[model samples]
Target: MDMTIDAIDARVVPPVALAYTKALTLPHLASAVRPRFLVLQPNGSLNQANSSDFQHGLESILEQATDGVIVDLLWVGSLDAYGIAALVAGIQRATALGKQMLFQALDAKSRLALEIEWAQQQESSVGAWKHTFSSNLEAFLDNFTHG
Candidate 1:
């Protein structure tokens, strides 16, 4: 995956700026081939105060994305059960829409929090390893786009 967030020229499209929850700092693939994925970087406290924004971002990004999305959970300051539930429900909605939603839990703390929450949900169902995103773009794409 691309580690750097490409800056966008605001004069071009304002909705691109609005797509991000609080920023317009991702993707410059226009010169290159079409981008098949988008990354969602949600930050700050993810409680009742901002879960609505997060969900709105998720929904809007999914509409903008062509293939899939990787939600980076590293910068989140805090998360509650509601935040966790939003993620789970968002992933299910993505699946229903035939789009992939992969959680990019870069650090141990985020990984543990998401895994614990996911484990609780797994008791009632199961899916493949596509739910998680890896640093290796090749392997992650292989796993996420295929079985």
Candidate 2:
């Protein structure tokens, strides 16, 4: 059965044409063991259809990371529960290893989704939970990596 949907949970965010875009990663800090900035500059909606790809890509890249991933949701025009779950899963992995994670450029709806899901999980907000709304990216990464 083929059906059409009118909108996403993020009604304010205009819908974007789904594209086969992958998250782009770069080494933000050289000396740090953890705090690797895994930027998710995806060019498509992080929805149910692509959650697995997002999660796997994130985890695969994260496996090489030490501290946390810097999820840049600047290009993510749409987000759903599954996407949030994937993000949380990565955060859970980082937390299990006793490290903090950070994300930026997230919309309020998506951010709220994460917060609501986080409240339900009841996990320690140690590694991935500590968030600084605004700061110089370089300085933040430096401060994030050190104790």
Candidate 3:
């Protein structure tokens, strides 16, 4: 996995800037390529105040991503109804665009909040589709790499 988040042009496309530990690497052409994680991490707090910015950035990331996107929720201090709405919108857009959106590293509080929000979105007893993982590496290994 790539330890440095360098070389990506910030002008052309803004990188997902955040402090992180694990990155996901998948095989490319039968070789282990460096993990290029494009995760959307909330800066400061996630609430009604910054929902629009978050939503715009997320949509842009999803649009530019070739494989998909990884949303890192570990640093989010809090989540409100507006934040939930923005997140749902981003996921819905990704789905409509046929892009995979993986959410990872959710703390207990964040996980519960998301679970509640997702439950509300579901019309049936069957759960709605949630692409979540313990870590970005786990998501890549499970979804992309062949054992």
Best by lDDT: 1
* Ranking of predictions according to TM-score: 2, 3, 1
C-alpha TM-scores of all predictions: 0.55, 0.58, 0.55
- The CA lDDT at 12 in model 3 is 36
Q: After superposition, how far is residue 79 of candidate 2 from its true place, in Å?
A: 0.1
Q: For candidate 3, what is the lDDT?
A: 0.60
Least accurate 10 contiguous residues by lDDT in model 2:
1-10
Candidate 1's error at 51, in angstroms? Answer: 1.1
Candidate 3, run of 10 with poorest lDDT: 1-10
Q: Is candidate 1 or candidate 3 better by lDDT?
A: 1
- For all candidates, the clash counts are 0, 7, 0
Q: Give the TM-score of candidate 1.
A: 0.55
Error at 84, model 2, angstroms: 1.1
Point out the higher-scoring one by lDDT: 1 or 2. Answer: 1
